[model samples]
Target: MGRSLVRHPGVRGCYTAGNKRFLQLNELDELRMDVYENVKLYKEWTKQWHDSKITRKEIIVGDKVLLFNSRFQLFPRNLRSRWSGPFEVVTVFPYGSFELKNNKGECLKVNGHRVKYFYEGQPIQARGELELEDLPSLWDE
Candidate 1:
């Protein structure tokens, strides 16, 4: 003897219209539940995928970094430079806050996200001997 298929709860019969078959109300509900579960799984995967691509910047005190000038971005200009300073890092606080010192001896506290490591074409060299002429004075000439 052949086994009979059981109807879903509250579903009396299959729905059909114009050569297309439709799911019963309970079956449709099950499909919706499956879709919801899939959406949640995809959301988690997307978060992991996004985080995997992010490169965390390692910052420390005394490091030289360039601050991104967001103000310039507001007024879009062809020739305007958006980055300013190879500022010295004076302090580092929790959660990406950093204190920087500029050439004018002005100190500013800013978020780490706005700063990036300063890069020059060549590496800086430090010599043990101090040459007075080579050193820049604190006071402007």
Candidate 2:
């Protein structure tokens, strides 16, 4: 005792794997199977999952981080390229954004997503000949 299939132009029967069957409970079974599959797939997708990530959340202002430089523009015909380098975190704004200073010591403000962070940050030194003592020694400083 199940409901009938949705009427087709020229049929009063049901379709299984391929062929037509006359008045079986096929439609009801198919509906039940589809509902069960959908529920199963949703549960599997929403189950708990683990991912490797840095657990620390104490990045404060004045910390140094490395930014990423990529040529691809998010907007069409964007004039300036997204530039990145060792920048000092100058000020943390209200939201998840911070003011940054570039390698030349110029102040520029940017959002969090636009700049990436480095765990072991390095100080920016001038190009050409940078001697060992000229750069801030990581261990010593």
TM-score of each: 0.65, 0.42
Off by over 4 Å in 2: 1-57, 73-83, 119-141
**Cα lDDT of model 1 by residue, 1-141, tens digit:** 253454556767633342123335557889999999999999999999999999998989998999998873555987967789989999999999999999998999999899999866777788699889898988977
lDDT of 2 by residue, 1-141 (tens): 353445555755534433345334578788899999999988776663322333334457978866656556566456754555668999988766778887788998776766666566387888887688887878985
List the pairs of residues colliding in candidate 2.
none
Q: Total clashing residue pairs per candidate?
A: 0, 0
- Regions more than 4 Å wrong, model 1: 1-23, 72-74, 123-141
Shift in Å, residue 128, candidate 2: 22
Tell me how far the alpha carbon of residue 86 in candidate 2 is from the true structure, in angstroms, after superposition. Answer: 1.1
User: Which pairs clash (backbone N, Cα, C closer than 3 Å) in model 1?
Assistant: none
Q: Over the full model, what C-alpha lDDT does candidate 1 score relative to the true structure?
A: 0.84
Computed on alpha carbons, the lDDT of every model, listed in order, comes to 0.84, 0.68
Give the local distance difference test score of model 2.
0.68
